[model samples]
Target chain A: MKVLEQFEFLDDVRRMDARQVIYQFLNFCMIVASALMIWKGLMVITESESPIVVVLSGSMEPAFYRGDLLLLTNHHDEPIRAGEIVVFKIKGRDIPIVHRVIKLHEKEDGTTKFLTKGDNNRVDDRGLYAPGQLWLKREDVVGRARGFLPYVGIVTILMNDYPQLKYAVLGCLGIYVLIHRETN
Target chain B: MAVLTFMCFLSTYYNDDLADVNIKVGSVQVKNVADFTTTRERKDLAIINNLGVKVDLSQVFNWNVKEIFLYLTAEYSSDVNALNQVVLWDKIVMREDAQRIDIPSVDPEYYFFDDSKGLIGNENVTLTLSWNVIPNAGRLPRVQGLGSTTVKLPSTYAHSSGRI
Candidate 1:
């Protein structure tokens, strides 16, 4: 019965006036564009390429659990210090690792080389880095964690873990928007 | 939830005081060891002896703070590197654990490895205590303690066969 109802909704879309269909399409586009604009604005304000990240591993346990949301800011003027949590990307690795800066060496020319370690792990992140990479330079750092929100990123994790649920949610939202009646 | 987090941040944002913390370095033993982790060259290894730390961090904890990551670092300047900061010891203070940290003598948790021979006879090596407050939902503020101590490494290095 639910499948038949959804098929009837598809028929309703076909029967709609061409002008009305265009208006609905334009509304959807407007929503997506505004979301993109907001994201870009945040990137500009924070000075970070990716301003937000979700904790995906338990290496930083007791402080940052899985599915926690983290706000990051990367300022070129700010020097990375010890004990500061940073999100860095290794060469050839797609996923960025979030760890705490434990050791740092700064040269006279203002270049800094540092080492990172997870809180729960016994050793530093040398094994996690690319082969022959002894130290992480300033360019490797993505951003420094500024703020945190717990358990708010569970929705994103769930969608990534279950593709069927993602499709179902997207399909339902699309259908609802298409059939939505404007009172104005 | 957003409002609550904002309110929590506002309440503790101005409270920057980390309370009184005392750190002392008794005797530092410096040795040269082969560096397999990084460059194949020999590295200066400094082992701290009779390290004493006492701090009452009970007042540092607020409702928003979940835990505190305490670390002791050795900061020095050398010809090899203008500035070198190596963490010698660290501890995690949970909300349920006693916040009053008092230790007369303790073993160093991590090795103090320098890329070059910076730790040998370094006269201006300063050991400072710093902490990062892990909040339930707010900014992660890193505040350094008020007190620190200096240690001078011996001019000669210890034997490599000595127990680390």
Candidate 2:
């Protein structure tokens, strides 16, 4: 009986005003909703499943490096061309590759066949392709390069390279934001 | 409340933006070139002797020496008659060593293609060169590199010399 009474007393002290708690929860929900909306908006505008990507390798060096952020847009009407850099995912490979289109071979049936070569390597990317898959079709492309920023993705690389650091940073930020909430 | 939410969103976005790096593709130049043409007897199909190829290294940059492994490979379409024929048509043709420079010099004579057996037909050929650039090696983590162009054959036609 005594323990139950103490528990009730602690719960009462910990309970925030209903209005204030509702306000905070609603704000958090709004932020989440807005983020979702923005992502959906990008998907619609770019006509791509993924509008943003990070460079995972140095295959496209001098143009894009590891940790660099890339903006992509895939409009089906826009034909893939030689000399343009692209991000594409190969079968069985989890990460996508960024390389330049060195050759374009169009089949008689209106299907496009293409070859990619890294800007930094000596030859084309046939070795990177799946076994016996000599060419990449239009369906394999994620997006064409629209624009990019330099070295800004290093923090992502650091976080990924050291997951503990990421959790610690996130925890600290969450605590700081909660504890330092403005009373006004 | 709205202001707080906006601030939180902005902070998250800013944090996300700061985590990644950016790299750009600049000019690409051919630094090295190799040609492989061979003829062989195949019971399945007739081979063509007019097989000609060009392998070129365009450019490389922003590489970490420690994180990459550089290898040069050539893959061709398997429809050619000389799929496994070994022919010593040419002696040592071209040889080039990898170097650390803005533009590495690649001699075209150290590499050669043997065409003694028979020429492979309709096979798409591919060549690859890969290398890892070490990070924090005092040198800039980024690099702009080049490769060589194909050497002209006696009977082969020349189209602009493949110069970058």
Candidate 3:
């Protein structure tokens, strides 16, 4: 009898009205959905697979440093030029590189080949290329750099550096929103 | 709201600065003056020199100009004043509109010439080439405001007797 009474009391306190529960759930979902929409919008406008990137290393130092944010756009019709900095992904590598184009070779079939070298490095990126591959094709390029923000990617870096802190922050935000009970 | 706006503005400002030029050249040279055909079958002149001395700009297809000027300045250790005089003479000759020469190309016509030439055979030879780019009105992406090359020629080329 005592156990049954305790269960009923606990259930009463824990239960929330359906409307209120639905309202909070919808609000959270909307916020997440909007973020995804904006990201997709950026992808379309930039015409790139990844429109935004964060500098994870200092390979492009003096021009771009670690924790910097980069904006990129790729238009297929536009020809790539030498001296311009571009961001590209190598196969099997999770991250991309920002480097300057040092050489370009156009073939008779209208295809183009390119070689890249970082500003701070002593040599070209031949070593970084895929096994036995010497040059980068147009498809390898993710996007050409249109612009960049300095050090604004520090938040991302911090989150990655401190995985525990990232979880703690997310936990705190979730708790705060749940307890505040504000209707928007 | 203020904080969000500030963040947005700061990000944009830094983004612009990050797009600045990052090319470095310890030396540059322009050579191999010969007519050739491009993949497009356009008549173009091939100048093979080492931009690869520091870095090569060969892959860049959206060149703004057809003709590029190669400015040369040579210095002699014996006479500093003579070096200045040579540069001054070359500047005068280069400034004359008639001195500009046309360099043919497949896509667009270009030219190359010395805007200023200084002494040869003393100490060092410094050359600057400013390309005459076809105006694209900034529509082209990442062009970095046309192109310029500076070359330091071999000390032997600075000799007064080396002129052709």
Candidate 4:
């Protein structure tokens, strides 16, 4: 009975004025829109579609661990060098891989191809590439890691792993925002 | 936490430097091997022996540093591609481990293969020592050591049967 009492605030919504209800709903939308605008701004500034990424695997252990936050930047004009950590996506693969560049072959015309291998792994990532694809081109590079933060992305990873937890948190936040009245 | 991490980043951002390194390549031997991983065609695989590396990386260690990923890359220009860089050897130096590297002579850890026969008689091949300083929370600065050495590769291929 006590657990269900939190939802009793639904009655308060019916009692609130129409203008006040609309004002709170608009405030919620503004918060979401601002978050989206910030993300899009980061994409433009970093030149990477996804400027931030979470390390989901331990392939680059001792450097990046699971749930670590990585800041990525993709400068199309800059050349990728050896020993740099790069995040790349393979064709048909949904998840991107973060690895170190061990080999680089650049042509005179500014076209370059490179091979990657995880620092923790024994072999190169040739097997992970698309079938018959020996090298990764500049187009395949999602971004190059520039900054790192430890254990900041655990919340995102946990939400992805557990669907119910994500829904519960989102629902609670929505209800709290809708019922919260600003006292002038 | 964010302020502390930012302070840690600023403290080591410019202070970290990798210098006083000496690298020597004694000999290079190229062999023709089947490229099973990629093209599936026979490619030139070059092996460097008696590699001498001496460096003091203890100064790179700090509270903000987690680990150092050190590697020796061979950079050269080939006919097929203008710029070619290949990593021949690498090592991970944890904060607790010894930071000084004093190898007298050792073979490379990884196979140095060329897409074509570019490794043969490459006189301008340069070997440089570089490392990535992994931080607890900050920029991943890559620093190249001060010293590097270039060695010429043998024009003829070594017999694949004989182990060098």
Candidate 5:
């Protein structure tokens, strides 16, 4: 009976490492905070709300696949040109579209309107724009694509497509960190 | 580790096989049309004449290259924004066999009108042939070809073609 009690007490102590638990929790929080800070810093440097974007569709087939990743930069003073790929978000839409600029209309007031089309697509993006919106304004542009990597962003796509998988992975990570005690 | 090696291999592979690009601005026709398709208030706009663009992009093809998106642009200076650029024509080359493009007399692929009505009286506009190299993997880059021509638009407005 005494041996069993001692075993139970040892298990309890091992399960509830108070100092270790607090340290692990704080480490997790620090990681999350640093990630956020880095993302926000990138936004400021790139002058784009989302400096990095994952190619979500094959509309820009042959140029960008569904899983590729694109790096973007938005220079407010820079003049936009034709044939350049730009990522723009339409009004009332959460998803952004990446396409090449097919046309540019520079107004006398220095504001320019852009017309975009996918290289694989036959028709222009007139139908993709908002109702009564003939052209995309400068304000509507998210950023211009500067660089890209192939298929690294598939992880993001997988996470979004399978919420169960995402939850499972996240839960496993959390549990592992919480239970893991530093063997110093 | 495999991905890193592949990326390094791709970056080292520099295939500069683009032979040549030739573009000829056939004519510049100015017209005024009242169309509901465009939101422009001005009825006067520049109608680009069919371009005689001959390109041998066969050399630009490689194992990593997917497609070449070529566009003909009319770049000119204006008081509005210091530079007024518009895409007059564009073509997508999926394969090298489709490289020899001979469009005898065709309108601009998209609208060729300028926002500040700068297309009219825009003489000495430069026409350039540039292409965006789409790759199966690695970085996508825009390359400007050596083919370029100058077009001078007549000051008078030509008769309308009744089409955009």
Candidate 6:
């Protein structure tokens, strides 16, 4: 059976020399490092710490849905405007909320205050802010919504929602990578 | 799959040949409202704006555009603040339905209130229309209107039955 063959392959991998084990480990490390490098490169190009984001909720509705991937950009020169969607994080919250900038208040300083609201909701996002926080400061904004792609980020969302599934996939991938030998 | 997705994302765009837009600001009046945002005793200055706009965005609805977020903004220079842009009104144009929007005369959809209560006799105010084209799989590009108008608020408060 395929399972028996996989077991035999695992046995063969265990019998391999120490150099083979080190080589496989180095290959795995290279894969992880390159993925991190790619992410960092994207961050640098987009001018945002979090260059890519997945839509976790349906607040944006007909335009964006759950599992949709969004590209973000934050420019220092351009101030945020009304009707443009923005992704921001409150002081005490870890999750970022995506909403439209309904109002702008520029202060005596150059910093502009932002009032945001969800398009599908009936009211503004005053309730979503921190207990004492009224307007979002410039630093609170992560980025403005620039590009969108639908339904590709579902794998990540699924993994997040189900820990067992995440572990299972990771375990399977690790085992497969370790057992399979590449022919050069 | 990745190649197809990238192609789909890159295919749609807002026309470089922009659409025509017209904005006219009628009058502005200042009123006092309770400051719900802050505990400051000073009443917030709520300016009532009457505006008229005609937008022909039929060309913006390409094959990939899902909707267009159209809004009218009031930009002015403040003594304390360097620049102030307030959104007075807005509407969503769905691709399946209408594209051109016309308003003979209408009040602002949202309240135009200043936190500092700065506008009382300010003469220099500019009104311009703008839109965000929402595509199915691409970047959201903002487009500015071609025409803008100047508005001057009256010195004193104006009382109307609807507000203020």
Of the candidates shown, which would achieve the greatest DockQ relative to the real structure? Answer: 4
Candidate 5, residues B1-164, lDDT tens digits: the string is: 65874675376367554556677665577776654457646555676666687777767776666778888888877656566677777777886547666666645676666655565677768888788877765556777777678777778878766555
| Tens-digit per-residue lDDT, B1-164, candidate 4 | 78998999998878756667899777678887876656657777887778998889888888988998999998999888899999989999999988898988855777788878788878888999999989999999899998999888888888886342
* Best first by lDDT, ranked: 1, 4, 6, 5, 3, 2
The lDDT per prediction is: 0.89, 0.48, 0.48, 0.89, 0.76, 0.77
Q: Looking at model 3 chain A, which ten-residue stretch has the lowest summed lDDT?
A: A7-16
- Candidate 5 lDDT at B79 equals 57
TM-score against native, each model: 0.92, 0.51, 0.54, 0.93, 0.82, 0.88
lDDT of 5 by residue, A35-98 (tens): 8999999999999999999999988887789988888999899877788999999998999999
TM-score of chain A of each: 0.90, 0.84, 0.85, 0.93, 0.88, 0.89
Candidate 3 per-residue C-alpha lDDT over A1-184 given as tens digits, one digit per residue, 9 for 90 to 100: 5675576534432455777667667777787789899999999999999988888877765456788777889888887655556889899998889886654544444466666777557567888988877778899999987755566778889999999989998887765555446635
lDDT of 6 at A171: 89
What does candidate 2 score on TM?
0.51
In candidate 3, how many Å is residue B63 off? 28
lDDT of 4 at B115: 72
Q: Residue B97 in model 3: shift from native, Å?
A: 33
DockQ-based CAPRI category assigned to the predicted complex of candidate 2: incorrect
| Positional deviation of residue B90's Cα in model 5 after best superposition, in angstroms | 2.2
RMSD of 6: 3.0
Candidate 1 clashing pairs?
none
Per-residue lDDT tens digits for candidate 6, residues A1-184, read 4665666657657666888888888888787799899999988987888988998998877678899888999887777777789999997889999888877867666789878877777677888999978888889989899988778789989999999999999988877777677765
Sort the candidates on DockQ, descending order. 4, 1, 6, 5, 3, 2
Q: For candidate 3, give the docking quality class from DockQ.
A: incorrect
lDDT of 4 by residue, A27-130 (tens): 88988899999999999999998999999999998788999999999999889999999999999999999999999999989899999999988889998999
